[model samples]
Target: MGVIVDEQVLTCSIPPARFFKAFFVDSNNLFPKILPTVFKSIEYTEGNGGPGSIKLLSFQEGSGADVMKHRIEEMDEANLVYKFKIIEGPKMGVLDFESVSSVNKVEGAADGGCILKSVVTYNTKGDNQNAIQETIKKAKEGFVGFFQATVGHLQSNPDAYN
Candidate 1:
């Protein structure tokens, strides 16, 4: 299988602890509420919300993809790090990818804000370099959208995820 890796970094004004709590720890509840048009729901299909757990994220109608299943590989709450692997998804089938995994880390910045660093690895089935790149582009865009929405929500609702 051909492997492709992509790295991204995003800087936000929110503090690392707050951002991590809202975006990572509480995403299953916050995402659907914030992006109702895009996300239908996020629920655990197996185990609790921890390592070895399986999460199923269902998208709303006309959202291009129906649902995605992810397995939590690691979760370091104290260090604000999370890792997960996409076990099933329409995107994987359409793009001919064998597997997709990501590691997200949030760190405190000098200005009291936070920086989010993400590393995504894609395992492809064949020599579809172009397709893999396109998928990576879309994934980056999606991450930005989600990040912005979460930031907005946390900014507006000060009590959220406290």
Candidate 2:
């Protein structure tokens, strides 16, 4: 497998706790409702639906559903970090690959808000290591869409975010 590396930063004006809780901590239930265009549905296929749990995300309506499927490989609720593995779908080479996602909290500007940065490390099916640029671009676009939708939704309805 050929590893593909990419990083994207998303900053939200809302408080970190609010954005974090809504997006990361409680996203499985809230994301589908907030952004159906990019999130058709998220279902827990294994584990306790918490740390070490694995869930399935299909993108028929969410994010075009062309990139990939995910499996949560690890979780750390206290630190607000989790890892997910790519199980299937069309990303990188032939999609038969392994990837882990790490979510790290970033210190924002003087204006306090949550800056959640997710770095995904992935690989392709073949040994050629091709498609790195395209794969990275696609991942960045998908993540940007997610963050934009989330920030817009929260801004429109502040009370809901709380």
Candidate 3:
């Protein structure tokens, strides 16, 4: 199998604690309410919201309306770090990958905003590596979009999540 790894740092104007609370802590319920167009719902199929938990992310009606199942590999609330792996989903079809894992570390930036360090790894079946890169690109875009929408929602209604 072939492996593809990528690391990216994304900056946002939202504070680290608030962003993590809304995006990671309360996402299971808040995501669908805030961004129903992108996520239909997020449910826990196994465990709770901690490590080893499995979440099924159902997408809204769109081009590829498929549910992606992910298992939480690690979570550190104190450090604002989270890691998970896609155990099942159409995303696995991108490069016939055996597995796709992502690690996200959120830290407070000097500007009072936050910086997200994202690392994505893809384990493919063969030497075909082009699609692996494309998949990572799409994943990064999705993460950015999710954060942007969450920030927008929080901005419009300051007390919505707090």
lDDT of 1 by residue, 14-100 (tens): 999899988888789989999999899999999888999999999999976899999999888899999999999975775579899
Per-model TM values vs. the true structure = 0.95, 0.79, 0.89
Q: Which stretches of candidate 1 lie over 4 Å from their true place?
A: 93-95
Looking at candidate 2, what is the lDDT of residue 70?
Answer: 61
Give the 10-residue window scoring lowest on summed lDDT in candidate 2: 91-100
Residue 58 lDDT, candidate 3, scale 0-100: 94
How would the candidate models be sorted by lDDT, starting from the highest?
1, 3, 2
Q: In candidate 3, which residue pairs clash? A: none
Prediction 1 global C-alpha lDDT? 0.90
lDDT of 3 by residue, 1-162 (tens): 877788888887788888788888778998889778888899999988899999999998883647999899987888999899999987476446899899989999999888988898878886656766666677778888888888888778777645
lDDT of 2 by residue, 1-162 (tens): 666566777777888767766776667887788777776777777775666666777566434455345666655655656667666666523553544455555445468877777777765565544455665677688678777777888898889757
Task: Candidate 1: give the clashing pairs.
Answer: none
Over the full model, what C-alpha lDDT does candidate 2 score relative to the true structure? 0.66
The number of clashing residue pairs in each candidate reads 0, 3, 0
For candidate 3, the TM-score is: 0.89
Candidate No. with top lDDT: 1
